[model samples]
Target: MEQHNRFWRIALLSLPLGVFGLFVIWPLFSSFYYSFTDWNGFDANYSYVGFDNFAKIATDRLFLQAAVNTTIWMIAAIVLPTALGLMLALLLDSRVAGARVFKSIFYLPICLSAVIVGQIWTWIYQPDWGLLNTVITQVTGEKFKYAWLAKPDTALWSVIVAWSWQQTGLSMVIYLAGLTAIPGDLLEVCEIEGASPWQRFRRVVLPLLAPSTVVVVALSVINSLKGFDILYIMTGGGPFNSSDTLAMHMYNESFKKYLMGYGSAISVVLFLIALAIIGLYFRQLRKVDRIYG
Candidate 1:
C-alpha cells in the first residue's frame, strides 16, 4: 500500500511540475533571451545585440508616454477601486434593506467581458449622438458635444474610468469577505467603550483589514500593468498613442510594426516590474502574518 501511494503521489506532482516547466518557465527564459536579439519574430537570421533593445527603450518617445500612462493607471487602480470598494463594502455590511440585491447590482460589471465593456463605453462617450452628450444637452438646454475618446487629454482617463468600474465589483467582494471575517466580539467591545464610529473604524477596522488591503493593492497593480484588451478594443492606442500602456506598446511593436526584439525587451521590463511587485507582496504578507500571529 505504501509503495502504491508513493507512486501515485510522485506521478501527480511530476505531471503538473513538468507542465509548468515546459509552458511557463520555457516561455519566460525564451522571452528573456529574445530581448537581447534583433529578431523580427519570423526571420531565422538575427543579430545578438547586447542591451541595444534596452538602450533604445530609454530614449523612445512612444515608450515614455506609455510608461507615464501606465503609472497613472497603476495609481488610479490602487486608489479609486480600493476606496470605492471599501466604502461599498462598509455600506452593504451595515443593517440595510435589500443588501443582497444591491451587492448583485454592483458586482454585475465584473461578470461582463472587457470587450463588451469597452464597446459600451465607446458609444457612451461619443461626441454628438452619445448618451452623455444627450444628457448634458438635456440638462443645460444646449447641444454641447465633446470628443472624449478622440481627444489626447481625456482619452486615457476615460478608459481608466471604465476599467475602474469593472474592477470596483471585484474589490468590493474581496473587502466584503474581509469585513465578514472580523469578529463580532471585537466590534461589540468598541461599542461598549463608547467609541465614536470614526474612532472605532480608524483604530480597529482599518488595522484588521491590512491583509485584505495588501491583496487588493497587489491585484490592482498587476491588473494595471497588464491592461490591454479594453484599451485595444476601444482606442487601439491611438490619438497619438496618448492612452497606450506598456502592454499595448509591446503589441503594437511586435505585431503591428514587426519589431519583435524591442517588444520582447519591453515585455521583459514589464515582467521584472510584476516580479518585483510580487516579491513585495510576499514580503508584506510575511509581515502581516507576523503581526497577526
Candidate 2:
C-alpha cells in the first residue's frame, strides 16, 4: 500500500515537473549556453566567441547606465512603497473613518495588470492634457506641460513613482495583517505604563512588526528585480535609454537588436545579481526565524 501511494505521488508530480523543466529549466540553460556564442537570432550558423560578449560589458556605456538605473530602481522600489505602505497601515489600523473605502481605493491598482497600470499612468503623465499636468496647471494658473515620460531627466523617476504606487497596496495589506496579529492587551499595558504614543509605537509596535517587514522587503526585492514590464510599457527604455534597466537592455539586445548572445550574457549577469541578493535575504531570514522562534 505504501509503495502504491509513493508511485501515485510520483505520477501526480511528474507532469508539472516535466512542464517546469521543459519551459523554465530549458530556457535558462539555453541562455547560459548562448551567452558564449555569437548567435544572431536569424542565423543558423553561429560562432562560439566566448567571453567576448561578457567583455563588452566592461566598456558598454549603455549597460553601465542601465546598471546604475537598475540600482536606483531597486533602492527606490524597496524604500518608497515600504515606507508608504507602513504609513498607510498605521493610519488605517487606528480605526480611521472610512478605512475600508480607503483601503479598497488604495488596493485597486494592485489588482490591475502592469500593462493597465502603465497605460493609466501614461495618460496621467501626458504633457499637454494628462491628469497630473492639468492639475498642476490649474493649481499654478500656468501651463504645466512638462513631459514626464518623454524627457531623459525625469523618465526613470517617473516610472519609479508609478511602480511604487502599484506596489504600495500589497505592502499595506501585509502590514495590516501584521498589525492585526499584535495583541491589544500588550498595547494596553504600554498605555497604562504611561508610554507616549510615539514611544509605544517605536518601542513596542515596530519591533513586533519585524516579521511583516521581512516579508514586505522580500517581495519588494523580488518584484523590483523583475519589474521590467511596467517600464517597457511606459518608457520602452527610451528618451535615449534614460530608463533602461538591465532587463530592458537584455530584451532590446536579444529581440530588437538580434544580439542574442550578448543579451544572454546580460541575462546571466542579471541572474547572478538576483541570486546573490536572494541568497543574502534567505540567510537573514533564517536568523530572523531563529530569533523570533
Candidate 3:
C-alpha cells in the first residue's frame, strides 16, 4: 500500500513536470537545433548550415558595436544604482521624519511598466521642446538643443540615464532590507569603540552587507544584459543602430527579419554570456567564503 501511494504521488507530480518540460526545455533545445540551420521561421525549405550564423555574428561589425554598448550599460547599471542605493538605504534606515513616505516615493518607480517609462523619457529627450533641454536652456541662458536619443554621441548615455532611474528603486529596496537585518548589537559595539559613521560603515556595515551586495549586483548585471523593452520602445535599436544591444539586435534579427535560425544563434550566444556571468558570481562567492569563513 505504501509503495502504491508513492507511485500515485510520483504520477501526480509528473503532470506539471511534463508541462514545464514541453514549454521550456523543449523550446530551448529546439532553438539550439535551429541555430545550426538556415530556417526563415516559415515554410519547409531549410538547410542545416552549422556555425554559419555564429560566424556571421562574429564577423558583423554592428553586432560588435552592440556588444560594446551592452558592456557599457552593464557597467553603468551595476555601479551607479548600487552606490546611490546604498547611500539612500543608509539614510532612510535612520528613521528620520517621514522617511517611510520618502522610501515609498522612491520605490514607486519600480512598479511602473518599462514601456511607460521608455515612452515618457523619449518625450523628455526630444531635442527641440523636451523638458530636459528646456531646463538646460533656461538655466544656462543659451540655446541648448541637442538630439539626445537621435545622435550617435549621446544616444547610448541617454538610454543609460533612463535605465538607471528605473532601476535604482529596486537596488534601494534590496539594500534597505539588508540594512534592517544588521544586528543592533554590532552597531552599538562600533559606536562604543569610537568609530566614526564612515569608519563604522566601512568596517562593520559593509562587510555584513556582502550577501545583499552580491544579490543586487547579480540582479543588476542580469537585467542590464537583458535590457530590451525600453531600448526597443524608445529607439528601436537606432538612430543608426547606435543604441543597439545584443537583446535588441537579436529581436530585430529573429522576429523582424524572420531569420529564426540567426535569432536562435544570437539567443545561444546570450545564454552563454549569462552563464559565464553566473559562473563568475559563484566563483567570487566561494572566494569570499574562504576569506571570511
Task: Indicate which candidate wins on lDDT.
Answer: 2
Selected candidate, larger TM-score, 1 vs 3: 1
Q: What TM value does model 2 have?
A: 0.96
RMSD of 1: 1.5
lDDT, candidate 3, equals: 0.90
What is the clash count of model 2? 0
Instruction: Report residue 148 deviation for candidate 1 (angstroms).
Output: 0.7
Q: What is the C-alpha RMSD of each candidate to the true structure, in Å?
A: 1.5, 1.3, 1.9
Q: Give lDDT tens digits, candidate 3, residues 1-293.
A: 99999999999989998999999989988889999999997878999999999999989888898899999999998898888888889999888899989998888889898899999899899989999999999999999999899898888888888888888889999999989989988899989999999999999999988977887898889999988999988888888899899999889888999999998998898889999999988987787677665
TM-score of each: 0.96, 0.96, 0.94
Candidate 1's C-alpha runs over 4 A off are 1-6
Pairs of residues at least 3 apart in sequence or in different chains that clash in candidate 3: none
